[model samples]
Target: MLNPKWESIIRFKCPDGEVHYGEPTADLKSARVWTGLDVWSLQPTDTTRHVAEILAPYEPTTIIGIGCNYKGHAHETGIPLPNHPIIFRKLPSSITSPTSLVELHGGDVDYENELCFITSQPARNVLQDNALNYILGFTVGNDISSRYWQRKDTSGGQACYAKSFDGFCPIGPKIVSAKALQNFQSLRITTRRDGEVVQNSNTSDMLFGVRQLMAFLTRGTTLPAGTLVLTGTPPGVGSYQTPPRFIKAGEVLECEIEGIGKIQTEFTEVNSKAA
Candidate 1:
């Protein structure tokens, strides 16, 4: 059986401008030494600089994004209730960790702080009856978007390009497993920008719960171990606000869930050869 304790993590920033993975430890002295030597000693410290050069956490194999899963978000968008769960994919390259900078382009960026869960096993056609068994954990996510691209239906594709931009999917500080949720059906999701409350809703609003979502996605596709499913976001996404607010450069975005820890990232514009 896997351990039920949730691991809290942060990318350790070294004096040389390098970011290395570090897990929390009971002994502060031991943890600091591990961050400085065990983690960073392995990477090259030669001069390679960008305005921001942080790397995304390296565990998730696939990122599955859910859409309109929250009743409030669905109602606010004026879309009819979905008969089945709506899903999308975030190119693995888009994933970034907490405190990294999310670049905004075309002068507008919107935020959707969301509740996301991870899978423990590889399962195909995961039955709704056994869905909870496959859930390894949950984490914080920011489903950043561009109002113009989404509303105008850019490129005439499926969902929207607003979702596919580089650094658009900001996830994690660490994973918080199912047992931590206490009762998965009752977790709460919250989001804030620069410390002002923007979104507050309960997970109970999910028309399709966590298990159902896993079952729906794996009906035909194989859900590999380490897959992350962003269950969905509530109403109050920046795009839906009156006059439509977008994230400006240097703005802070914070996403959190009751059991899962919070993730904070800043906003910047894309630069050539960006990470």
Candidate 2:
């Protein structure tokens, strides 16, 4: 019975190169602060002192990707519109912060911004009508893809490798409360590269609405609390462009969803030596 709308949590980096975790309060001036070496001298929270990689607000144990859930996207891909939600899984390791870098592995890496719904409770066989009840909140996600690895005869593409790069799934900034999105039936999603507007669409254009998407996913699977399901991206992907495109080192991708907030991440060249 975990309340999805309980106390809000903030994850921040401290000067000592450590990440601090705590509930944000009105008294806290800076959201992210530098405590310096004095961080070791500060008093601990009443519960327990944690001064390491601060746990993410939602420690997602699993993640799923709903593919081509948007009507426009399916048409662009020249694939038949799925009567049900098209889903895939992004490795939990892919999740990173807003300002983090999404590495371009010298391969054809493309950017696809998406809306992610985090689960609040373990659920299976949940009806679409009651889907909202299980949503904890929403966060922005970038589904970096390698088109070469994702293509198959006509259906059933491989994703585990192409979509699971170290920083391929940049997600965050904050998770807006579900209530904040009063009507998910209509949401505006936008993505910009550098300063040029790229993808822009509305959730209303989705071939499968959130409720139906959730129900379709839950039909045969037990979706646990902390599970994140990316609801797919709109058109304007680099892969489908006339000239063809791929993310290169140093490009910035910014995404914003109505009521959910914005997330911006840059691209960096992946070092094969370090990989």
Model 2 accuracy (lDDT, Cα): 0.72
lDDT of 1 at 77: 82
Worst 10 residues of 2 by lDDT: 34-43
Best TM-score goes to which candidate? 2
Give the per-residue lDDT digits (tens) of candidate 1, residues 80-137.
9999888777767668766677778544678887878777778788888888788776
TM-score of 2: 0.83
> Where does candidate 2 stray beyond 4 Å?
5-9, 15-29, 32-57, 153-156
- Local accuracy by lDDT, each model: 0.69, 0.72
Candidate 1 TM-score to native: 0.80
lDDT measured at residue 157 in model 2 versus the true structure, 0 to 100: 68
User: What residue pairs are clashing in model 1?
Assistant: 137-177
TM-score of each: 0.80, 0.83
